[model samples]
Each structure stands twice: as C-alpha cells, then as structure tokens.
Target: MSYEVTGKLVAKYDTVQRTETFKTREFVIEKSDDIGGRIINNYVKFQCVQDKTALPDKFNIGDDIKVSFNLKGTKWSKDGRENYITNLDAWRLEAAGSLAQTAINNAPDNFVPDAAPDDVVDDLPF
Candidate 1:
C-alpha cells in the first residue's frame, strides 16, 4: 500500500552510492500539526532509491510538496544480532498545491461554480 504526505521540504541530500549497482538519496520534510493549544512539528525523512534518487532534484528546499510513498521494513542478522530497518520509500513527488491550482486555472473564464447563494439559510443547530 502507498501513502501520501504534504509538507514543506526541509532538507535534501546528495545521492549516495550504496553499492556497485545501487544508489539512494534522502530528503526531509517538516510537518506541523496542532494539538490542544500547542503546535507540534515533525521532521520526516524519506528515501528514494535507484532511478528515483533524482526525484528530489527538481524541487528545492522550503517548497511545499506532496510525496507518495510506500512503507518498507527489512530484517537481517548481523554478527548474531537481529537488526531491523524501516524506510519510507518515496516514489512520486510533486508540488503540494500546484496540481489543484492548475486545474482551477485551466477552467474557462466563463465557468461558474455551483454554490449556495449569499443568503442561504443555516438550518444546522449546534
């Protein structure tokens, strides 16, 4: 399964040659959420491997971006010790809000959205 996240690009790293035939790149994004009356920020790091290593090239730091990724976990034994690693493998990345804005911008000038009138009654009670 895949998941998507939208946040501000915080940091990007150079592509790394993990193996003779394998390469990977990593980047970080800042995600903030409101909890109670305080705000919490989370810095999430994601990895792109192989052909996807260059995925972050077109985007600059501090840009609002949406990332589509898959959750990956691996287990291995090294020197009689069990080791586990988890990676957020990002496959698709794009501007967070540009896609939706582009659709609205491409709409014909004469196009008018169907919405409630100014005097629409509010019938719902709290």
Candidate 2:
C-alpha cells in the first residue's frame, strides 16, 4: 500500500548497511502539519534504499518536502528480546507545493538546463 505525507526535512544521513545484506539510508522527517495531531514535536525516521538520482539536488535541513511511500514494519527475535521496527520506504519525493509544476517553475531559472549552453548563444538545433 502507498500513501502521501508532507513533513519538514529534519535530517539527512549517509547510507547505512542493514544486516549487511540490505543497504539503506536513514533520514528524519518531522510531521508539522497533517491529519496526525501534535506530531510536530515528534520526528519520524524513514529508512529507504539510497537513490541519489531520485533525490533533490538542493534539499537541505529544514526544507519542507512531500513524499510518497509504502509503510513497512519488521519483527525479529533477539535473545528473548522482541525486536520490531517500522519505517516508510519513500519512492517519490518533491518540494512541498500547492501543485508539482509550481515548484518547478518557482525554482531558480537556472536550476536545471532546458537546453545546451551553446544553444543559448548559437544556432537552434531544432
């Protein structure tokens, strides 16, 4: 199952190895304003497979983001201690905006090149 969530980017950490077999990244995103009440003071850490290509190049601490992910949980036995964990495996991420396109257009004009630099000064390849 999948769901959408919007929160503040509280932390971004380097990738970590899980069980040496599954590698993942951990990042803390705090719930600021959502259906969940009084979550602003509580932060939730999500573990996901690091996909550098999918992350925003300009994301920084305190930035707000909207993510789409799947809620996952795990349970394991640990010498009589019950080990349980839960996290959201984010599959999609984007700057928080009223609409997706608005974030793109509102970004710095040079945020990403639409055409080659030569095309800007020389002949149109069209």
Candidate 3:
C-alpha cells in the first residue's frame, strides 16, 4: 500500500551517481498537536527519485512539505536476536510553504491518488 505524509523540509542532499541521479531529503512533520507536538518534532526524511519534474522548485529547507512515500520493510539479526524495521520510501515530496502548512491538513483536494494498485494484502498477512 502507498502512503502520503505531510511534513516540513528540514534537510536535503543528493547522492553522487555519475550525473547525480539519486537525491534524498529530510523533513520535520508535526504528526499530532494533541501529543504535545512531540511526534512532529522528529526529523523525518524523504527521498526524491531521478525525475526532475516530480516536485516543484519551491522545495527548500525549513519549508512545509507533504510527502508521499512507499512503506519499505527491513529486518535485522545480530547475536541470535532478530528485529524488524520499516521506513517510509518517499516517492513524491511537495512543499506547501509556511503559509499553507496549516491549511494543508484540512485541504480536501491536497491528496491526489493516480493509478495505484488495490488490496496490497501481504502473503504473510501481518
């Protein structure tokens, strides 16, 4: 299943790949105000693919962003102990600007779902 997260752009960097095809950025999102603004205080990072047309040019540090990402799962095992990890693989990063950050949460048309798969039920059915 694909998920979208709205946050702020806290950092940005590009990975070297000949012509620099890989680029990733981190953002800070206010997950919830009710949690005393703790969740939103964390630095959540998102990634942008090689496509230059994926996002607008307004994306900058300290700007509010709404990121759409894919949920990627990972596993770790060490010293007879195993653990699972998951990360948000960002596919699209949108900067909503500071003025629009508050309005984005309530904006009904902010989320746009194109052609996507349905029923992403895992075979393990966790």
Candidate 4:
C-alpha cells in the first residue's frame, strides 16, 4: 500500500552506494500539528533507491512538498537475535496546497456568495 504526507523539506543527505548496482539517498521533512493548544513538530525520514535517489534534488530545503511513499519493513536474524526495520520508500513528490486553496483557485472570477436568509439572525455573544 502507498501513503502520502505533506510537509516542509528539512534536510537532504548524500546518496550512498551500497554496492556496484545499488544506491540510496535519504531526506527528512518536518511536519507540524496543533494538539491541546500546543504545536508539535515531527521530523520524518524517507529513502529513495536507485534511480529515484535524485528525487530530492528537484526541491530545495524549506519547500513545501507532498510525498507519496510505500511503508517497507524488513526482519533479519543474526547470531540468534532478531531485528526489524521500517522505511518510508518515497516514489512521488509534488507541491503542497490545501484542498480549499485548490477550490478557490479553480473558481470563476465572477463567482459570488448567496444572500443570507431573512429568518437567520447574526446575533451571537462571543
């Protein structure tokens, strides 16, 4: 399965040549969310393998991007010990914008809101 997230590009790492035919690059993105009146920031790392390693080069640091990636997990056993690892394998990227922004941008220039109903009162105490 594939998933996507929108965040600001934070860091990009050099590509690593694992072997004669294998190469991989990693990049990090920062996502912010508001919870309980506090802002929380998370840094997520993603990997691009082989030809996809150059994906990060298209965008500069601080750029807002939407990344589509696959969640990959591997399990290894060595010396009677078991270990598991997870990776976000990025495959696609694009500029980030909210759905509302897209809608407003696509709306016609002559568009206008309808008038409020007569029975509806605007009185409210805040």
Predicted model with the maximum TM-score:
1
Better of 1 and 4 by TM-score: 1
Please report the TM-score between candidate 4 and the true structure.
0.76
Candidates in descending lDDT order: 1, 4, 2, 3
Candidate 3 local lDDT, 1-118, one digit each (tens): 8887666566666543445556443334554344765553555655554564335355666676677778887999999999998766666666565646655666676353342556
- For each candidate, give its TM-score against the true structure: 0.77, 0.63, 0.50, 0.76
Worst window of 10 by summed lDDT in candidate 2: 50-59
lDDT string for model 1 (1-126, tens) is 999999989999999999999999999999989999899999999999999999999888888888999999999998999999999999989876775477568879855544458755556896
Q: What are the Cα lDDT values of the candidates? A: 0.89, 0.71, 0.59, 0.88
Clashing pairs in 1: none
Model 4, runs deviating above 4 Å: 98-126
Deviation (Å) of 66 in candidate 1:
0.6
Top lDDT model: 1
Candidate 3, lDDT over the whole model: 0.59
- Per-residue lDDT of model 2, residues 40-79, tens digit only: 4668776668563236335778778887788988999988
Q: Residue 81 lDDT in model 3? A: 98
Candidate 1: deviation at residue 69, Å? 0.4
Q: What is the C-alpha RMSD of each candidate to the true structure, in Å?
A: 10.1, 7.1, 10.8, 11.9
